[model samples]
Target chain A: MSALFDYTLRLADSALILGHRLSEWIGHAPLLEEELALGNLALDLIGQARALYAYAGAVEGKGRDEDALAYLRDCGQFRNLLLVEQPNGDFAVTIARQLLYSAFAHPFWRDLARSRDATLAAIAAKAEKESAYHLRHAGEWLIRLGDGTAESHRRAQAALDTLWPYVGELFESDAVEEALVNQGIAVDPAALRPEWERSVQAIIAEATLAAPAGTGMQSGGRIGRHSEHLGHLLATMQFLQRAYPGASW
Target chain B: MSAGLRERALAAASGVVDPEIPVLTIADLGVLRAVRLAGDTVEIEITPTYSGCPAMRVIEQELATALRAAGIGKFRIATVLSPAWTTDWLSKEGRRKLAEFGIAPPAGISRRSHFGTDAVACPRCGSAETERISEFGSTACKALYRCRRCAEPFDYFKCH
Candidate 1:
């Protein structure tokens, strides 16, 4: 149960952090259509996070609900990937992040749809379809930016290169996930790497963007270690609850 | 009385139009999954069209309003996610209504349908000669498209 709780929290935290990161673009996205798109994707990720958080709370047999789990947790308590917490630098950087994260998440959710845990399977079934849209949306933009023009290609490539090191942490497998994997309740992140590579490489190749050369991999997010950006993010996201406990509309 | 209450609840719930897509009722959109009567209480189930659809809270309020208006004193609304909602669940009436409202219905083409591979008939001129402008559109469930023949841009409710 503890393993399941930890595994679910990992998924939940990643979704929440990434969703909050994307929500930062609500008023700042370049185009109106793109703005709506990013907002919509944020909404989906947050919704998935809510569901996962609720399940985690249930697994822990605690009184914590989604709100408590999401709003009350400190920065170090978060288990999201380092990739999700990095600043959404620019339009190109945002697209690069989405492309990389969705590339892994799309297949991860799809495979998770068949989990022995019925609740996880059901949530993943819905999330898989949503993530597929994100992957497609991100892939198209990455290709256009990478292949479009000299300036656009340069920015896209630079964004991809900068974000590439964080990708390794997404495929890291640890004991919590390993136990759940043995129980058929969780997926092995390592097994998802090959498929993630295929889709990401294809999109990158089509975009005329070369994959970044090997570099020092970033990890530790899964165990609650995160980038400095997460603290500021949580400060804003949890502000309302911190100021006024149990407040509601 | 139980049977009659169930029927009344169903009627009220079915008549509740989707807040986002006004032309279609919850029933037409398949958001109204099930309605049941437990003695004197009414229970309803609904599913989101998309994981993050914003219109769900409004729909819930509208349902409560409708039930009260129908004189259903005790009722419950539950959301279920086991079988994810899909565009395939959108009824024929809903699709026609969508087209009539100047929005193209789901083209029955999966999102994977590359740029020009699938022909999503334009709602304006019924033209199969259409091009997708953006995979993400005004809403999560839609994609932006342009009719080559009509020279008009429109929203296509892309398949999930």
Candidate 2:
């Protein structure tokens, strides 16, 4: 049960953090269409995060609800991937980050849709379609920005290079999920790599963007050791609950 | 009496129109999945068109109001995720209503729709020559498109 809680929280935190990151683009997107697209994407991610948190709360059999789990947790306790918490940079950087993350997430949610746990399976079933849209949106931008112009190509490639090292952490397997994987309740993160690689490589090739050579990979976010960005993000995200303690609209 | 009450509750729930798209009722949109009576309480199941559809809360509230107006005192709204809502579930009547309302309903089910490759007809001019402006529109379930023939911008209820 604890393992399930940890595993679910990991998924929830990543979605919440990424959704919040995307929401920052509101009123700042380059175009009205892009603004709506980003907002919709963020909405889907945050919605999925809420469902996961609710499921985790129920699994823990504690009094903690989704609100408590999301806004009450401190930075050291969050279990999201470091890639999601990385600051959204330029338009190219944002698209690159989304492409990298959604490439993995689309396949992850599809596979997870078949999980033995009914609640997780249900959430994944809904999320898989949403992630497919997210992946397509990101991939389209990646190709456009990567191959459009010399400056765009340079920025896109630079963004990819800067974010690639963080990709390795997404596939790292740990004992926390091993038991659930064996029980068919959790997906093996390592198993998702080949498909993720194939999908990402095809997009990169089409975009005329060279894939970065494998660098010294970053890890530890799964264990709640996140980059410095997460603390600041959480301070802003958790402000309402932290300040008011159980305050509601 | 309970069966009649269940039928009444279903009727009231079915009459509730979507907050985002007022032309379509919950029944027409296929979001209202099931309704039944468990003793004195009414149980209603609804599926969200999108995971983050903000209109869901409004729909729930409107449902409560509808039920109360119908004299239903106790009811519960449950959100079901399996068999996730799809554009295919949009009733034929719903599709017609959307078109009459100046929105192109989903053309068909195609994976290519995700990339805006599938051609959607313009609801206004009835022309099949349309270009996608964006894969998202005013709502999550729609994509923005423009008719080259008519030079009119419109919304396409994207096939999910």
Candidate 3:
């Protein structure tokens, strides 16, 4: 596969996986308002995944369309971040994961909006708006959970500590990212790290939550080496497609 | 001949109403991008206001039905994601229609304000004393708001 195609899949896969993860909370969110909020964010991510997958299909000059690319792919072929594929432990854990990912995604998409590639730029521009909302939603929840009752604060801190280690992989540059960055078609993930840190730290301070001293970077999702969680996620996500072979609404 | 055919197709497609907000037509919402004749087939392009808008499929199907009813046999609907759809594209007439139907039209283009304090005028009382109940409303494209003056809850078509 071409670097452009690979890079595009990397983007699409992250969105598709995260979208699926959020969709799991549809009927089970803690409250009605939160249900709607998570559902909307999930839909946005899925929509983003569809657009990116469509573009990737065109770039690959392949017959596979968005559905084929999304539903047909196995866990081993998926290219999402390890952070995204991790299970949604609790309300606080989900919020922590979202805060981290959306913090990274907002800046990443903003920088990507200025890319030389028109299609990528357009996608990034649209995604930037959505990611900003996602970041705000997660950030607001982080503050509420962190600054609320003692139990809530304890759970929020624990969630943040558990999720912090996985964040390092987001800024790990690989050959595909390197080539695309050099071509002015992709954002340099490493450059986004500082801004993400500052934004997260500011939110942490406001919430009265201690920032976790992250260690032991876990990587390799870009190359399809995911944690054990991804397989079960794909099992549920790909079930309808696998069962019916050709299903449509 | 094709140019005239395209106009007829556009006219037909304009009749398709938004599934979620049924009062406004797709054209009014600026979802219908273009209708054209490609060889013997009619081609239409539509943009989605939100990425996960459930109405897109319905709109596309409705447009096809409308086109077929207009004596156009072969047509294709393509969704263009570029130049992303924004609330700014909503026509003045569309805004009026939304307000008439008890939904407050978006105040301005959706921008992330740090304060989260956009003054949404209540459609019922036309009062600026409305407060946001939730950032998300019944649908993905709207926000839930309550009018303090009129004591009525309504949906605000969020700017996006």
Cα RMSD, each candidate: 1.7, 1.2, 1.6
lDDT of 1 by residue, B41-156 (tens): 89999998877788889999999999999988799999888888888889999999999998998877444432343468999999899998777777778888999999999988
Score every model by TM-score: 0.96, 0.98, 0.96
Candidate achieving the largest lDDT: 2
Native A-B contact fraction in model 1: 0.61
Global lDDT of each model? 0.90, 0.92, 0.91
Q: How close is candidate 2 to the true structure, as a TM-score?
A: 0.98
Per-residue lDDT tens digits for candidate 3, residues B1-160, read: 8888988998999889999999999999999998887798998999988877889999988998898899998999998878888898999999999999999998977687543757899999899999987787788789889999999999999887
lDDT tens per residue, model 1, A99-118: 99999998899889999999
Give the Å shift of residue B79 in candidate 2. 1.0
For candidate 1, give the lDDT of residue B141.
80
lDDT by residue (A38-123, candidate 3, tens digit) is 98999989988998999999999978999999999998899999999989999999999999999999999889989998988988
Error at A147, model 1, angstroms: 1.0
lDDT of 2 by residue, B45-123 (tens): 9999888899999999999999999999999999999888888888999999999999998888635333546678889
Backbone clashes under 3 angstroms, per model: 0, 0, 0
Better of 2 and 3 by DockQ: 2
Report the error of model 1 at residue A233, Å.
Answer: 1.4
